[model samples]
Target: MDLLKTPAFAAHVESLLKEHHTPGVSIAIVHDDTFSSAAFGKSVISSDAGSEERDCTPDTLFDIASCSKSLTAAAVALLVEDDVNFPNVKWDSKMSDLLPEDFVLEKDEYTRDVTIEDILSHRSGLPSHDSVYMGTKAKRPDTAKSITRKLRHLPLAKPIRSSHMYCNLMFTVATHLIETLTDKTFSEFLQERIFAPLNLTSTFLQPSSVPPADRDSRLACGYSYRESTSTYHAIPVFDTPEDQGAGSIITSVNDYIVYVHALMTHAPPFTQAIQKALVTPRFALPEYNDDRERLQSSTLIGLGWEIFYYRGHRVVQHDGSISGLTSTHFFLPARNFAAVILCNGDAGYPAVAALVRELIDQTLGVEPSQRLDWPEIFTRGRGVRGEAESEDADGEQKNEEEKAPSSIDTAGAKDMAELTLADQPEKERGSEEKYIPPPFPTSDLPLDRFTGEYHHAGYDSFVVGVRASPEGGEALFIDAADRCMGFGIALEFVCRAEAGGDASSPSPSEVKFLAYLTDVDECETEILEAVFVVDGDDRTDAGGKIGKARRLGINLDEDIEGLIWFERV
Candidate 1:
């Protein structure tokens, strides 16, 4: 019996989707060059009960997210071998030389020493400064070149080549490099050298660019599940010009299966050199001993693909997540097997990944007794390691008992905080105990003193201004709509710092304000402290009139302790 066509397999796939609350899924499996495809559930759920739901099909287009990296890596490989156009360029070509004006990192040494392979393999020592770009879609769009230029300001989290840090910004840099080298847009290059040649009709760089005739009808609507209501909410598609090389590919499993098969068989554009470059392990990923170990033995990263050992077979894969979709692509070259799962739900990676793992095991003819029930494990509350880390990131949110000046990552800290804490009561989003100002004496300084534009080169600027508070009073607020976190927040006066309770207690020199960040769904809330340092003193107000603040400190990223001070501009 065909594994993918079996009734038991179909039932398991549907059960996994229901367990994870994913609305729709499309999958394509390739075994020994034979293709099998399946799609289940509605791609677009109609808000009106009378309207017909758009059923997901093999042709339904989805944003493949980071899986696009494989295509970008392939494009670069083609350019490397194009001796007529790029005679001197090689895999180790220095980025500083390729895109000299735009490829500056924090340290001058890194900027000069970094190479094409370094960025492609994610060993450039840069962390995912994703906050710098995540929510900037509503604002003036940033180009790949502009994003690459912004790297000069974001500090590297570790020394170059010390470890593998998955940084999307590096891929964006690759996009810029491709554009600079070929004198064409990244999309143009891919279309000419890869997509068109392969006859991938459903693949496109963006939704708007998808063929107009089929655009609205064939594109899938993305969604995120709201556990509170047990309902799915539509999420806006994440399409940004700045994310081209990093995660901007919109493709269908039908089209992606062709590409993945090409990868497995060393098809045309995917020549021996390209296949070797794409599969050669460049760095060892951090060891994880999670439920995934039941299926795969180990994992490493090559140019844009993650190489893992599933039993004894080598599988190269990548997973991508954006606002409302998650995708996974897997291919085992030795067995001529490949598969892709595309789910149009924000939290669907777990189920989709389990399906892929199961499909791979079946294709390899692994003994049924030895096969792990991945979907069942996920239903039993255990999740894939990568998705668990992504979903639990907000576990680092500051506790209510913590002191003022506590901070969180502005990008996903708020959203992930909500997901991790959703099991908690909703009204407790900002309970009285949680919002209470610290015990320190209130400063007599006027609130106006803290109002100004606080600037961080990496995250741009945060404008602290006066706004109406929830309690019917004027208060200081940070207009963060244009920032990466994508929401504005109100700042409440917390307290003024004091040295000690003894007679030696010195006058306060810093004032704190509590900022409440609510998730987009308003299901939960997280708080951050913003403290401004008083530069000079005026005696009449409180101990003295507070001078203008020149620096504001907020602790960002709980894993990395310390305050991130934004200069008052």
Candidate 2:
């Protein structure tokens, strides 16, 4: 079969590299189970001293970040086929039951209730609250244990199956659970169950596990942009055995294609059941409006993937990012087309999505649809419809005025009083008008009330800690292993009033949490309305009942809105 190449594929890749100032990129396209790839720029940027340009190749390895979740999900499916009791198994299953007693749940309650489905669907309610990995102490295994122990004290943001909230803790917990069940670590289970069977040799969870001979030759160095110097710099790569199932997998475009093929073809019982489960929109994210024409009105979140409906086609895809690198892989099963793009630098996901859409259109022989240009459209509309205009007429041969006089100001007037007296507001006769600020009650409930540890029922290891700011206020902090990554590392909250302007009415509150990258880039933010609902004890707390925190919206940002939920806990 002739694989149709996009007319702008090469030029688009070049333009993205230049525009984003990316150091290196690796891309692949899959059609009819066959694949083709291209690479550009240098995997490692040059420093003050001269260095060889490290060109990206099709075989270049990239840290796939959260793309690892799909692989983990696939492994779970294999276990399900092995007659592992998926539904009946409690999340808090003793590590000693499956592994060693030393591997225990920190929060007895969390470990007790969490389940395999909870981890896979990201409904574990655990907040992505670890910042220790960014620090020097990230190498310790106790780091993972510390995070796990805190889960018992933390409160759930939502009840089980209430909504989706992406939790790294859940994935790690699932990894441990898999080891307990199969007598293997997460990497070992994946290698035995999924990778080896699919023949995906280049794919693995730990980067160090890959042969050293292939490191410099096939591995792409991760990079981050230095806005100060206007250049890219290499960022250090570190691994956490705990976060392995969540975001630690590293692989190449060619190997990821094999995984995507497995997803498309449904290699077995996993092929049919998991694919069906993944494409079903499990939750509704906030409506996202973006500059791209292809993304408007079409983005939704599946189990571990993103569901996009562009021009009447269903596209399932996901994007991954760590500190220095960003990666994206998307496929349209209906059109039998797939594209994987991995960048060594923080080039972002929008470009990758646009490229995939373009490729799909080219391969399917469909004309690309024009995006609505808001600025141009508004400009032209104003010209044709005309802005509010004024007319001046004399007795004979009165000509229309094209422009209004600048000296004649209309500030503070309710209507065009100069044009018509009836349309204007009545002026007070000899009385001065005073402007009064609206009265509203601000909550005096100390920020400390909001400052506490939060636990997710679905994830035993994840904990969110809100601390009093040294500046004399409260700031949110995330505790993953035993360390704290400062506020805005994983999630942030914005307080909004209940009724438009009634802040003093003691009105019910609403908070929106903005999830950001370690470098402080916004990923996917979620908004939860504070509603009074019955809790298990039939009492309302500051956080609200976990059951009511449903996913009311999604994907407002370029990143996929993972699991999002809200509970007082």
Candidate 3:
């Protein structure tokens, strides 16, 4: 029986496309060590003004996104096999040792002590500071260098290896280290070492590097559905992130089959023993996903894969999502079975839905009585469009504080707000000019040890500590480029009699800062300031593993609520 041409599967696929307005998709399945793939719909819609209606082929290119992590993990494993004489490539070696001599996170000792395994397993205690990797200003191989110096300023989301937060920044760090050790960009190394060996020619690390003819014709364009108009609009593809190691892989199912065979058999030209070791579960993840209210089928993260038991069978998998594409790759080594789905649409939809349906069909003995309504459960992969707040970001609550439109759209302005422990306070949507700053223009207290680099997930690092208040006062002499201050508000503004922002008030440990909706790169015309507060003993704290820094109390900013403890660098 041809399952690919089965009336039930075709009906299901057609129904899903109509329901979500998705344009194209590619599906690949491997069973009994054999592979088959099919692509449906045009790479671009027939109505797209500048694009042609080319049917997606089995070899059509689609951004694999975070699935790149698994491939990268394979690369690391391959290198580990050959690392006998490579002095800087040890899996257990501290990143500080592999990085450039001047690279240092003076305040955080844990940052320097991180191992390669820490990154692959998502235990580096770093959250995604993707703002630095997005948009036109992306930092690539240099991102490793940038983070090393700035990491001291970024607060750890959790203690070293104490928790898993799924960080792309750490993977970028790994890629950079790999580059430094091999003296080549990660893309160059993979091509020579992995892709060439497997003869997978349709895969590329960058869209620009795709064959020029295919780049313009066969590359799938991403789209987002707008509820307001009930239509899909094309979203721009981001081509230059240092995160190529973390999320930027683009390939077709035919080429990916070669990758799958490599995973299953440790395909010749690669070290068999090393590939065998890559799937070993290395880190424990939360056994129960609160949202699912059940133990995760895949509860342990492996070198670049997730290992879990499903229906009494072992499975290894990893999923990827970007603006326009959602993908899933899962394989059961014990059963010699695997399947991959690449959906050219918004986050969740078709890809996950397809994966779930395929898995059930391939694994269980029972046949579905009816086609499953996967969109009903998986919805959009990344987010549900037009919802007040999305509860689908794994478990994070997203509150988007809309910004004035820029010439270019940045990642959702409030996208990562929930990724951190920041507090979300609802405000009426309106212009920033109409809102008031709550009269927090001056401070009477000594700044004390408030001078240092303060880091936040979405906005990158802001300057604080020492003399860098945003309001005109003692920090008035500091250049705008150098001043990052906390604006205390209401009673949080009250300072202790000694520190002196104002006569002793109730929250002695708390301090606030001026936060505004602007870029925070420079002070702009009468722009409203959002208040941020910090709590502390007003003394320099030291003698920790990472290094010398002032340990301040939890700080709260107007747009966000979290205990921000700043480290002086």
Top candidate (TM-score): 1
C-alpha lDDT of residue 518 in model 1 = 48
Candidate 1, residue 338: the lDDT equals 89
Q: TM-score, each model?
A: 0.84, 0.62, 0.69
Error of 3 at 166 (Å): 1.0
lDDT of 2 by residue, 1-569 (tens): 33323555566577767766577788888787777887777776655434445778778888888777777766666665554565434323333344334333444554555555665665555444443232224323433344444455444555555655566665565566666666777778888777888788898787787788776567776665544445555553545465666678888888888788778877643567678767676554444232443343544556567676776778787777765677877788887777788887654444454456666666767654554333333323221211001101100111222121233222212121112222222221111321111111222323333334333332322333444432344444433323222112323343432433233333344434433222221111122122221223222244542222212221112112343232445
**Candidate 1 global CA lDDT score:** 0.70
Q: Give the root-mean-square deviation of each candidate in angstroms.
A: 6.2, 17.2, 10.5
Runs in model 1 lying further than 4 Å from the true structure:
48-52, 134-140, 380-384, 387-446, 466-476, 483-495, 498-508, 513-529, 537-546, 555-561
What is the C-alpha lDDT profile of model 3 across 138-245, one tens digit per residue?
222234445445555555555667765666667766777667778888889889888898888998887877888988766887765544346555543446444568
- Write the residue-wise lDDT of candidate 1 on 248-353 in tens digits: 7888999999998987788987788888988898877545555656656556779889887877888888888765688889888888888888989877867877
lDDT of 1 at 220: 85
Best by lDDT: 1
Q: What's the residue-level lDDT of 88 in candidate 3?
A: 62
Error in Å for residue 225 of model 2 = 1.3
Write out the backbone clash pairs for model 1.
538-545
